[model samples]
Target: MLSITGAVANSNGQKVFKTLKNEELHCSEAEMKAHLANLYEQQKGKCAITGIAMHLHGQDDCDSDMLVSPDRIDSYGHYSIGNVQFVCRFVNFWKMAQDNNRFAELLDRVVANRVADTV
Candidate 1:
């Protein structure tokens, strides 16, 4: 048993190598880019509550970790467009460890009663 720490390649090269060569799975830059693009489209390029186009997918702090992850594929969220939403960056990450549909109805709407004002 051993503990790996510090500058990765410098302080724990052997351990890092072992972990890197592990038979587990992982993601590549190309795949990440594609997934982010899909997420951007699914979230509608707008805020779920504001409905404005000020939302973005990847960045630091401002729009960091802003992805709509569906927890249930057969229940609350079916991993489809309907189950997805454009949420705040903080909420996105916080909900990452939880379900999303519970707060899915946070969308804004115009006063439908005034629809006849122009019609």
Candidate 2:
């Protein structure tokens, strides 16, 4: 015999679940929602590294780089409540590209590059 169950999801919850699954993360939909709410309270939508406000898909203009996303405090760590927080997608990708601790130096270089591009 087989048993089937149904889960009800609002659009936001569905979005969270999809993101987690796509990232191959271990968080449940409920956990992801709770963590995101807490992060919004604590960070007020600012990227932890760049201090710029994140743009969420439904709420703001959806720039892939500026979109809000979960970032693990430790690169290899699991996505537990204390280990994860929301950040700008750009910062998350930039941090993942190299070492997390070098964000300051990388930000400096990024600024210089922007300045050079305009010259």
TM-score winner: 2
Stretches of candidate 2 off by over 4 Å are 1-29, 97-99, 112-119
Model 2 worst lDDT run, 10 consecutive residues: 1-10
Model 1 lDDT on a 0 to 1 scale: 0.44
In model 1, the clashing pairs are: none
Residues 1-119 of candidate 1 have per-residue lDDT tens digits of: 13444344366435443433222113555654566578667657665533445434464444444444323222333344334445556455444435444434331113343565668
TM-score of 1: 0.32
- Give candidates' CA RMSD values in order: 13.9, 13.4
